[model samples]
Target: MIARVFGASFVVTILSLVVAFLYAGWSGVALCAILGILEISLSFDNAVINATILERMSPMWQKIFLTVGILIAVVGMRLLFPLVIVWATAGLNPVDAMDLALNPPADGAATFADGSASYETLLTDAHPQIAAFGGMFLIMLFLDFVFDDSGVTWLSPIEGPLGRLGRLPGASTVVALAALVTAAQFAADDATVSVLTAGILGLFTYLVVNGLTGLIEQDEPDDSAGPSEAVKAVGKAGLFLFLYLEVLDASFSFDGVIGAFAITSDPILIALGLGFIGAMFVRSITVYMVRAGTLSEYRYLEHGAHWAIGALAVIMLVSVDENIEVPEIVTGLIGVAFIGAATLSSIWANRRDAARQSASPVAD
Candidate 1:
């Protein structure tokens, strides 16, 4: 099962490494490898969150996610998205933006023909808006999860009250908007408007996607319905869920894409590393989790992933302050720590349950 799931990712990783080596020798290979690891570390929780959604999708939709959805992730989000950002923010034509990306100055400090900052600089310059949007979206996701009264609770003291409060209408939106406003205050004066606008758009995007998904699912036939009706309902819901997963991925990738520039500004390496290798493995991991029933086996795993997402949202918001710097490693470690702790807790809980069952009286 492991080989079947990860085989494609392995092939892609090899090809990406070879391409990196051919493009810029050993240094390129090293940078590509590092960026790939960085992306995986940052996105492990993403795979968990994705699996929760993917499990509900039909088999056909699942295949599409592994195929067409991957194309969008690798090409659209990883490569073209950054270029488009640079183009739109830098006020350069698409052709020039592509050129600037493909052929960065050797010194890593050269400006554009109009004497604007370098490609990397412009991309980083757009980070405030990016962070605001992605951060708000993730904040909403985390808040909604914690606010949910269903399922097991990992942190009862905190999640319990939040869940009770979440019963109020539009609780998640109110909290997310409050967070958006708070994050905006920390933004530089020039970036404040952009931050607020992006954050609101992000919140709006989540509402639209989530609302449509809920509406579609609500129309699904009950158990007494015919197989055909059930299949149709699943298809409709799956389509919207697939879209939700993609947008969630885009939100997750925002930090990784911007952080990649810190290691190397070469667009090819970034695409090869984060897009091909890193993203492929994340998809494989998502599939593995679904097939293995990891979430079911480890009760608190989902809670851990959501908690990590909350941490990431805060990190992104806090990062809007140029004076404060949070290392990518710090972000990665916090996620890993949460997941690790959850796994341990799950194991302990399983053992305790087993012991209780053994101690219970049985019927003759």
Candidate 2:
């Protein structure tokens, strides 16, 4: 099962390394390897959260995710998206944006000969809006899950009250809006409008996608319905779910893309490392978890992933104040710690349950 799931990722990783080596010799290879590892560390929680959604999708849709979805992730988000951002923010034409990204200004040069901001500068300038949008979306996701009372919870003391509050209609939306407004207040004067607007848009996007998905899935097919009807229902729901997953991935990628500039300004290396290597491994991990029934066995895994997401959301919002900066490693470690703690708790619970079962008298 492991080989079946990870074989393609392994092949991709090797090819990425080879390309990196040819691009910039050993230094390129090293940088590519580091960025790949960084992406995996930062996105392990993403894999867990993805599995929760992907497991609900049909087999055909699942295949599409590995095929079409991956192209969007690697090419659309990692490569083209950054160029688009630079173009939009810096008033550069498409060709100019691509050229600037391909050949960044020398070290310590913030702008080009014509005085326009460099690709990295423009991308950094756009971070506040990016963070605000992605942060709000992720916080909404985390809040909805924590508020949900239906699932096994790892943090009962905290989640219990949140779940109770969730019974109120639109509780998550109210809280998310409140958060966006509060964060906007702390943003730089110039960035205040952008932050609020982006955050609201993020909140709106979540509502539209999640609402449509819920409305479509609320009516389960009756026993009298033919198999074709069931298939159609699954197909519709799967499409929306696939969309939700893609947006979720985009939110997760925002930080990684920004952080990659810090390590290396080369767009090609960033694509090879984060897009090709990191994303491939993450998708494989997601598939493995679903196929192995890991979520059901561990029980608390989803809870841990959500908690990590909450931490990430808070960190992103906090970092919107240009004066403050949170290291990417700190964010990655916090996620790993939460997931590790949850795994330990799950193992303990399983052992206790086994003991109780063994102690009971045999029904026979």
Candidate 3:
């Protein structure tokens, strides 16, 4: 089963590589690989969170996530979205932007109507937006951790009581909406607003997708005892699992999709590299967790990832202003630290459980 999954992903990866090589040759291939690894590593926490969501989905949905959803991410978001941005903002005719992106300009100066490159110009022009995005992300994270009603909060020492005070119904959603409104206002004036908007978009997307999914989920009918019934149950579970997986995948891809700009401006390379290679690895890792039922076994892993997501959200929020700067490295490392600690804690938990079982009475 693992081989089949990896094999399929490898095929896609190879196709992406071919496209990259065709566009920019060896340099493009090398750059894509390096960026792919960086994107995957930086998003390890995202993988964990995605697995948690997948565990709750139905099998059919999981398949959709792996297939159709990936196509959207790689083709629609990673490739097309950037092109759209360049076209809309930079006033490049749609065809021209597409042409420039597909066949990059020979010289940076030759790429633009203004004698500058689109990618470089967009990114540089977008520095304020990127900075804004980072700030807003951080703030969203803070609000999430601070306001969560989860039982396994690491911030309980402070949040346990204080959090209780402002815990209103739908507070997180409200804050997310507010963040979005703020971002919309400042998106034009400052890049920070755009960052804030993206974080809000992330939160809003999560809630809407998950909520709709829960409402549509069908309950399993009980049967006296039959293999057929068990099979039906498994099928339903997989469908729901796939839906949740897609939602999670979309959320996790947000940063990496945007962050791909930091690596190279070749939209083709970004989409092919991050969308296919990077995201494929993430999906593989997520599937491993689902198949292994890692979350069921390790209670704190999801918690750690959520905490990290919450932290990143908060970072995004604060980044709206110039008062602070939160590096992507710091954001990623903080997530990694949380996951590392959770892994150790999970091991400790398993050991404790085993010890207890050994000490308990057994039937003769």
- Report the number of the highest-lDDT candidate: 2
Give the clashing pairs for model 2. Answer: none
Residue-wise lDDT of candidate 1 within 1-364, one digit each (tens)? 9999999999999999999999999999999999899899899999999999887777677888888888989898888898889887878876777777777766776575667677788888899899988999999999999989885699889888999999998999998898889889989999999899999999999999989988988886445556644543365787898899999999999989989988998888998999999998999999999889999999999999999999999999888877777889999999999999989999999999999999999989
Question: Once model 1 is optimally superposed onto the true structure by TM-score, how far is the C-alpha of residue 301 displaced, in angstroms?
Answer: 0.2
Per-model lDDT: 0.89, 0.89, 0.65
Candidate 3 structure lDDT? 0.65
What's each prediction's clash count? Answer: 0, 0, 45
Query: Per-prediction TM-score, please?
Result: 0.95, 0.95, 0.77
- Tens digits of per-residue lDDT, candidate 3, 145-230, equal 56766555544576576367447877766766676566455444545445555555556555655555554445553244464444
Pitting candidate 2 against candidate 3, the one with the higher TM-score is: 2
Residue-level error in angstroms, candidate 1, position 95: 2.0
User: What is candidate 2's lDDT per residue for 1-364, written digit by digit as tens?
Assistant: 9999999999999999999999999999999999999999999999999999988777787888898888999998888888888777778876787788878777758787888777888899999889998999999999999989875668989998899999999999999888888888889998999899999999999999988877776664323556544543355777888899999999999999999999887888999999999999999999999899999999899999999999999998888889888999999999999999999999999999999999999997
Ten residues in sequence with the least summed lDDT for candidate 2: 220-229
